[model samples]
Target chain A: MTTTSETAQAAPPAASTVPPKAASRAVRSKNRIDPTYYWMVVPVLALFAFFITLPALVGVFFSLTNYAGYGDWKFIGLSNYVNIFKDPAILQSYIFTFIFALTTTVVVNIVALAIALGLNAKIKWRTGIRTVFFIPMVLSALVVSFVFNYLFSNTLPVLAERFGVTPLATSILANENLAWLAIVLVTVWQVAPGATIIYLAGLQSVPAEVYEAADLDGAGSFRQFLSLTLPLILGYLVINVILGFKGFLGTYEIIVGLTGGGPGMATQSVAMRIFSGFTGGDYSYQMANAVIYFLITLLISVIQLRLIQRRGVSL
Target chain B: MTASTFSKPVNKMAPLGLKNRSGRTRKSGREGYKVNWWLTALMLVASLTVLLPLYFTVAMALKSPDQIGTGTGLAWPNPMNWDNFAAAYVATNFPVAFMSTAFVTVFSVLGSLACSSLVAYAIARNWNRRFFRGSFVYLLSAMFIPFPVIILPLIKQTALLGLDNPGGVVFLHVLGGISFNTLLYIAFVRSIPVELEESARLDGATTWQVFRKIIFPLLAPMNATVGIFAFLGSWNDFLLPQMMIADPALQTLPVVQMLFQGEFNTNYSLAFASYLMAMAPTLVVYILAQRWVLSGVMRGAVK
Candidate 1:
């Protein structure tokens, strides 16, 4: 090693050696590692590992055993995995989870994109309108769902009754097909504002020069949107998809408040399934379900992030 | 819907018909005039679907339970039963829950900023290190690793550490958020030029003095935005409390809200009343911070 270093130092006359020297210097510096950031993370990493990483590991371990929330944990190994495929309700929950995610994802994006475009138009009284629209996002999902329960499911029906039309209450949530749609509608309403806010931020970052060029080229609104706006904001579009997916996996409050995953367990998503299991005193089993669901969400999110990053348009 | 002293042709060309002056123009050749009017109107109605329900909520929350639950009381809660809010306070464990929430929110915010920023400063200002970089990426990816995978271990760890209490819960939340918090702060620290630090160094300020006296103050803007967001996030969080906080004395508002789901049947009006009560802080905070908050999100997007 000493001879190698001595030769490297002594024989480095080539032009390319300059670049290699810098690269090696970087490697060496990286090896030594600064303590500043590391020290700062002492408290954070302690908490992160304790609360986030450790619990995750415990959850995975719990999934492999029958803890019953107490008593000796029997190491059943792959039995939990087997029961996942075997149990119809468990498999059905996955299907419903996917549908819930897909539907809410589409609806939130379309509505948010439109609102973002409107906001981008810079209409009069927009701040007021935007404030009005964005207000729902501030409410916890439980709170939002309760308000909607009265307005759409109860009060709107009363108004409709006055006109002699059948009430439009979401008693249909007790039905299998419509229950999904009901939750979807409420979910879209609650989250659409958040998506709009993100998109609006993205839209604002588009340079005025790009738009000016589009206008000068005789590009109309649609043309400009197609060529300039869409291409430029692909990053935001992908982000919205990921956000929608997270929202789907994480959604428990609204589903719990609105339907309790009822109508024969139709609307019970993976999150809901875990929650229900927890409430029902089947803690270990549900944690296993959550672990499976988590893996699926992680795989999908990583794939999506990778794909978008690969295709991302660098500014 | 009222003609509004504007015309379609005008707004189409000029993007008019809004309630403000986005630019110095009255009307030009209607810019987006000929585009689909139905789509915009549909969007408007859809947007109103969000507003109208909220309107109804405010309307009913003003009424007595008798008025709200019975008869046609949707027209501004006849004579405005403002006592509904007072009743809501008692019915929902409002005071105690608020205290719990406030206490939790305070610690979560302070802890997150402190832990996240310290780590962030280290990562951003410190010299290049592969170990740190690798770990940073690992940490960021872990956020997407599904809560179920980590949540169980976290519970075990928290339990081991006696963090299952309310304060402990806040501690867990702060730690849970460290990765994202660090990401935000590290970015902020990197954006600060090195010249400031070099100048401080020339003046012989200790590293802590430089950070406290200069770096921390400079980071105030980004800190405000991130802090407020983290505060709001912790305050509104429902899932953790639902699973964790078992003691009624320690229950947050969202936890109390869940109690209305009684076995027999729920009192819908009382539940709705409680829901509105729970939403007050979030609504108030956003309203107060919106001017800065909106711009903050814009700034964050590029970073």
Candidate 2:
């Protein structure tokens, strides 16, 4: 690094016969360290270490013990971990959380991509339509869930009854078997617009010349889209899927607002379970569950970073 | 490949009419002006579907008690009863909740901006240094650590330190938001020319002065983005404040609204009215800053 800077400085004055070593030293001194930069970063780093890193480490320690969130007793290594696997509620939450995340990721991606494609076209009222779609992206998830709860409970059923639809006569949120679907519907509604914006950006970046070239070869629109557009936006798809999946795994407020984990805990996410544990005085067991959850997210994040790096996704 | 290459030169001088035809087709294709009315109509329906819940909330909020339980509540309220809002305002203690929410949002936005930008500036300016680079990576990794992973111990730690109030929640919000905000600021800071700060430094301005006078002013756009994001996150947040602030008087708007909903579950008008009240601030802000919010989502996604 030092040598490159030296050569760069020396290249501008090739006629001068100055010593390379001396010139490099001069440039290095010109780039002298500012102690204030170190000072400026201290508070941020301190807060990060104390508030984030320390608590995380403490959490890991507590996961192995019988810490009731307040007065602690002796450590019981792996007991909480063992109990987590045996607990039906935690296991059920894990299953529901994964199901919710996977289903939402797939559905949101397809719908978002479709919306992006439509919005990208030269249609009338494009900006107005885009804004309408994107409005939910800015609203609070909790608020949106509550609003939807009313619709599912009151409005939709009333409409269903008027239309003579037998199945929808009852509120969906009150049904154990179907309540998770309502949560998924709301999640998709709230999240698809944000994904649509990302996909729209990706769509905009696809070169028009590629499609034009394909047209000259007599390739139809579907073939052109398949052969040209999807490949170019594959990176964006990976990003949306990973980020959306990880985010949905942390779902809490929406569940609280909609069904409050449902008629029988059928829709409880891992986060809901963890919070309940805190309130229920099952602190260490929930700490163990949280640690496992942390590791799963960490693994997925690592995989995502690696995939982006390998694909060289600039966006 | 050889045949196509040789034929391309010969076909390059094809009829002018044919060329124009192809050119027109290409232009039309590029602009996508061949309107698909079906798709346009479909998108309109989808937008309406997405807006239905919001429409229902507002409609329900505007209805009276008699109008709500009836099927006609789906339609607009005839008399347009405004009493529900008043009842909701009283029941939820809207003034106290609104104040608490505003305090958390404003302070969190301000604190996150100040700390994250300073650290970001340090890292961006000292890009070649090992420590700063390490700091950047360390901060970025914090993004992977979900809040639930540490909430149990965090509650204990905060309680032990006697910081379990709205103030504690604000501090946590500022800290929790620093990683992403710092990342955004670092990207913006890198684009700012160092010569401005260097020249100021050479003129004997302290490093703090250089940052305060030059660098900070240059980061106004990023400050807006981060501030809006921090505001949204803090305002919408329920879990941290719900867990941290035990006192009913100190609860944020979302938590208060949730509790309020539980108390007045049977009063659909008052319930929906309070819901609208809770959501109004964000909706207003979103409408005012829709352009920035949209662009910011795209930009943040790119990172």
Candidate 3:
């Protein structure tokens, strides 16, 4: 609000105040509606409304009915929602998705921060190593998952057998108990680079002078990292966690490629459930589930926004 | 400045001059300040984690069926096979899928840049208006709606509108990106000095001209950031294309790859070859623009 007033003061005088036949015909008011700006925004807004907003609303509307994604339907009025809460498969997906999201978020942050610290250190070929580390981020997730799928199903077992490692001799993707770990490993492998870059940015933003001053105080590196580095980069940590958690919540493609949410739904995510339901003649039922999922995500987003705003973070 | 200037010579000479009474040179480097050999070694080992899988992809692609079955997966194939690539290429109709993917990636990047920047410019400049502010929030709200929630409805809608094709994917990509990209762009557009636009306005430039001639050029850095995200997101996307594009012939690379996985599954060499080919363009672009891509991702994170 203050910024608005400040910018308004910063702009030129309003166009309406000036006469029509003024010598200088610059008729502009930064505070007022500019038709050209309206033109620029309206089309985008319209497209967004038509594509995103409309579909979302339509999805919600259908959630109240028993529409099977086609043909005639009747309003079921919360029946699907009630069934969703009671369904074991749906419940299982929720449990798996949350646990997966949490585990991956924690694992990724730890690995990423460590890598970022290592990259930040005065190491040889630092830039080269950093470049190598980020390679996974640029590659497609599904392709990477396929490559890993082959590794997990074939190569790993073969290697494990020859190495005399009994526990890992069988393909982990076939093991319901252990398959989620494979997903987590691949996810951490792929997503850690992105998080590392963020942590690196956070680390780099802390002036070297602070570390040097800590050195003068004879503080150990561990102590300096604990008391100085962590506190300063806390903002980046929050950003990484919020963004990473939100993203991991919607895990889809990697699951599809790696395990197909298989070993009897052991690795199924809420997204996989919703998608399968859509095609498997559970349209309205899934829409109800989706609505609930949307609410949860929306709640998280709202909380994230409030946290960011309170911290005076730009995003 | 004074502390650094005074400390420089001492810092340089300490390693040479400092010696323990026991006649062995102590570790003069600060434990945290200097490189830890163990950390470097550990990181090197970690780097192998990235390199090894990529190595396997290449190795598996070139191996004969007999060789692949006989050896440890780490072994590289002798007289590496080029036939797999040709076979995979023909099987996947590589050029069409590649072109379809390329088409989506290019337009999505372009559309995201144009629309998000325009919206940001409008909302940013008119910050005092409730409508503009509300529009910003409205777009941001779209971010929270998980794509799966709306995808089923979107499929039905697109089919009815005769948009269940690659073009529809492009439209959705652009529409989907507006939220975060506008968030990125609006922050950037606000940072741009109002004086530039004001001067342009006084020069009888219309609002459109002011934006085009001044604001847009200044937005190059953010454009790069947004463009990189848009490219990667659309290029690597699987779900939208798989569901949205009704025609098999018009599907994107990721979806097409998934569709043909069954056909290639019996042949390890062929599957790896197809995956490698599908991965080639992104790898090439990343290698060529490594610096920009890395920095762009970092910049995006700050937002």
Q: Per model, how many backbone clashes are there? A: 21, 0, 0
Stretches > 4 Å off in candidate 2: A1-32, B1-36, B70-72
**Chain A TM-scores in order:** 0.83, 0.89, 0.90
**Tens-place lDDT digits, model 3, residues B1-303:** 111211344332111111222322222334534556777787788899898998999998998777788456679889898899999888888889989998999999999999999999999988888888999989998888889889888988999999998889999999998899999898788888888876666545667788888999988878988999999999999989998888898788888778545733568888888888888888889988876677666667766
Candidate 2: residue pairs that collide: none
* Model 3 misplaced stretches (Cα beyond 4 Å): A1-25, A30-32, A306-315, B1-37
Interface RMSD after interface superposition, model 2? 7.0
What DockQ does each listed candidate score? Answer: 0.28, 0.34, 0.39
In model 1, how large is the Cα lDDT of residue B175? 67
| Predictions: Cα RMSD each | 8.7, 8.3, 7.0
Worst 10 residues of 2 chain A by lDDT: A21-30
Q: The CA-based lDDT of model 3 is what?
A: 0.82
Q: Residues B8-59, candidate 2, lDDT per residue (tens digit)?
A: 4343212110122244233456544566677779889989976777787888
- The sequence of per-residue lDDT tens digits that candidate 2 reaches over residues A1-315 is 354345546555543655544343334443676577888897778878988899899888888888776574679999999998898989999999999999999999999998888877655676577778887776778878878887888777888999999799899999988999999889989889878877876775676588878878989878977988899999889989998999999998889889999888899999988877677878878889999999999999989989999999876
Candidate order by TM-score, decreasing, is 3, 2, 1
Fnat for every candidate: 0.42, 0.60, 0.64
**Which digits, one per residue and each the tens of the lDDT, describe model 3 over residues A237-314?**
989999899999999989988999989999999999999765799898998999999999989988988998888764
